[model samples]
Target: MRKRILGALFSYSVIGLITLGLIEGILQLVQLQSIRSIEIARKLYQLSSREEYLGRYCHSYIWKSNFIQAYGQHREDFLSSSGLHVPHKTRGWTTKPNVTVEVGEKQYTTNNRGHRSQKDYQEDERKYSVLIVGDSYTFGSDADDSYAWTNLLQQKDERLQVINLAVGGYGIDQMYVTLKEEIDSYNPDLVMVAYISDDVFRLKYDFRDYKKPTLQVKGGNLEIENTPIGGIEETHQEIKAELQKEDIAILKLDDLLFNLKISCRYPPYSLFSKVMGQMQLLAWEESAQFLAVYLASGAEVEEKSHESRGEEVFQRWAEENEIETLNTRPYFLQGSGYQGGHYQQAEATIVSDTVYDKIMDLESWKKFVETNR
Candidate 1:
């Protein structure tokens, strides 16, 4: 009897170990398949930082970059690069003018596809004839740096060399200063400002927010403030200012349990989101607004309004100074083909399900910029 019991225990132990091993193996396999199934950039990201381009990040079978702003995204998801709005990198507007060369410590390289490229960072080119500046949209959030507006701008005018000095998360204030400092060095024919609506206005809230009017006519000379971002007086204190709008709707633990019980009884969008995610064949162009708007959080909806307001001021400033200002939003918003929609690693939106149209039209914007700018 004792021998039989001992034998039984040994058999059980062996089976358990095998079971655990199999589970781990299966998990790893699933992870691998998931990585493979999802599209990734074909290149490897370099180590050094490029001051003017989108940073990149990569892993085996997986790659990511912040070059494309996933519309209506929060500070969630995998961060493979120094993404916009993170506030950790770039030292945020406090650095000195002209002397502030990009350091190697924190820059990454990202391609157009949400994939991180593979390459070591190195200062390749410096001498450029024309420099363009703006926010993520101007910075080419969804596409590779080469596909960005500035890159397109470069192709259009062969005689005029171009530099995309647009950084992510920057408002007009940074644009004003960065241009003033770099303009003399590059010294070109035109100062083209590829202003993104979302980036032009200086919200009384954000730190880098400051707007300069297009024209201040003093004795008939168009006077541009173009001040270094520091001199402006701040109105609303950021840290203490209470949020007036948007209900975040945080749930308590008990409420979560009750909701979970209901979810088990019924079903939720989680399953639908998964199914839609699996079927890559969905035509984003057919139903761009439906998907994106449905998933849009209230805060995101509000941002659209902000972008419009900011664009007005920025355009005025650019025009009065004889600086060329271009708006690329409408072109991207009205895309008609597949190339116009479907972006990856976008800022995870509340309206993630139906945002294919916006993704497809990115090229149209780039193309227009290339031709016009």
Candidate 2:
């Protein structure tokens, strides 16, 4: 009887261990399937390659172009220092410059001359030179000088000599200051301030790097802050700290896998896209909020957003001042709302392609330039 009882206990123990193993196998299979569900055409990064991304993680630069890294900010795969992306060839007419153009303190090399590359553009004073001002879009990141909307605008109408005064990571106050300094040098015919919504909160983040005159509103009038440049150093230090955090990749396997799928997967919009957007909104609240706040401040603070931060300040100023600005939010939609400030990732970007192209269209660019001029 004793022998039989001992044998029964051993048998039960073996079955329990087998059950646990089976459970673990089932869970791993479910996770694998969950990952496999992504279906989309993979895209390649236009500038950097995957091997470059792996190298970048180990602390190395990927592309030779300065604009490539600047544009890659915010969105990981869309603009990451990492090179895990489908190659996107630069559009024709947007080739590397055979010449260089200087804006602010930075110099950009451009292939402005087809086969004939000029050394530099010394503002031909006689021509009606119109400089288009904004942020990265105006500068044309991850793209050549010609690919910039300003360049595309120039191609549409030969009458306009459009110079892009857009810089990556610049806010409205900075832009306004840049304009104040540059206008004297370039003497643009007209300034079409494409004030992005994201420019609003930059003061709170990189307030130190902000050297422009502080702007204030008193009874519907705009006032420059006139704050000393001495105040900006502290803000620059904070910004540097934030920039340093980019190197830390302390994320979970599932989190990393999901992002990898989204980064590699093009056309994030699909039957399952809404679900993905929901997840992203949950994960990226800080980014979204920052965009909302800065975009509002980018415009003249005299105005207020009806919960729409940027529109209240800048849009109102544009309408009242006739800045020839184009706000693409009405024709566009993204979860909470669609305005130029929010960063579109994965499927949201794919979904917004039409709106983006419409804004980027030769005809549309021509219209914006013509109106602003």
Best by TM-score: 2
RMSD of every prediction = 22.1, 17.7
- Whole-model Cα lDDT of every candidate shown, in order: 0.33, 0.38
- What is the C-alpha lDDT profile of model 1 across 1-373, one tens digit per residue? 9999999999999999898666445433433433445333111111111211112211110111221122124333222133332222222332111221112432334332211222221222332233455555545456553344444444443443445566654544455445544554544333444343333223111233222222133563323443322221121122122222211223222222333332343212232222222211122222111111111112323334434434444344434443212343333343322232212223222112122223224443344346655
Worst 10 residues of 1 by lDDT: 42-51
Clash number by candidate, in order: 34, 28
**Estimated TM-score per prediction?**
0.34, 0.38
Q: Candidate 2's residue-wise lDDT over 224-243, tens digit each?
A: 46444332234335334544
Candidate 1 Cα deviation (angstroms), residue 28? 51
**lDDT of model 1 at position 65:** 22
